[model samples]
Target: MKKIDERYIEVLDQFGFGLYTTTAGCNLYHDSSWGSYIVNFNGDDFVEMFIGYAETFDPNEYVSLHIKSHRVIKDIGEMLKSAKEIQILLLKVAIEFVKISKESMVKADV
Candidate 1:
């Protein structure tokens, strides 16, 4: 694992995402209810963001990008944009996931 830029933690921390280290990886950012992001680094220049679900370290999917300056790289710059990517990718995904999951349990009589 490469050293995680503090800016990543700085942004993610605002969203209840806590950084943890498991056998899976060192830069694991998890939210108890909103899924997880397993960050894989490449020689301090790039990263792969893996999104996990159901309280596990293993992610269901991923998106990769290169690290860039303030103006940003086209893809991941979104994550750094006032946390919008976190909201859309993690927070919003969690909300919709839970909603869809619970729909099956809804009482038909109600």
Candidate 2:
């Protein structure tokens, strides 16, 4: 499996996401105020991106991004098709979600 690049890690860290690599070699990022993102790799490609919060926050909430490698090029408009594309796509969505989540929390506190 292709490892997540240091540049990507840097971006995530700046966004307040803590990175943790599992013993089995999966990548997981945790954001206390939002939730966790667990990347599931299938062979040389990413098969799924799971975004989930702790039960303490919201037990009923569970979100996932299913990445069909063969369909990614068509769906995401990526000229060069590959698993690396998943990383880029996932990062963009994750960052946006974090921004939205933080905004929602701020509104709730008002």
Which lDDT tens digits does candidate 2 get at residues 5-93? 46446655665545556555555554332223444333432212322311122221221133333323233322223224334545564
Tens digits of lDDT, candidate 1, 75-95: 443434423344365644344
Clashing pairs in 1: none
Clashes of 2: 0
Superposed Cα deviation of residue 27, candidate 1 (Å): 6.1
Clashing pairs counted in every model:
0, 0
Could you tell me the lDDT of residue 65 within candidate 2?
Answer: 32
Off by over 4 Å in 2: 33-43, 46-60, 63-110
What's the lDDT for candidate 2?
A: 0.43
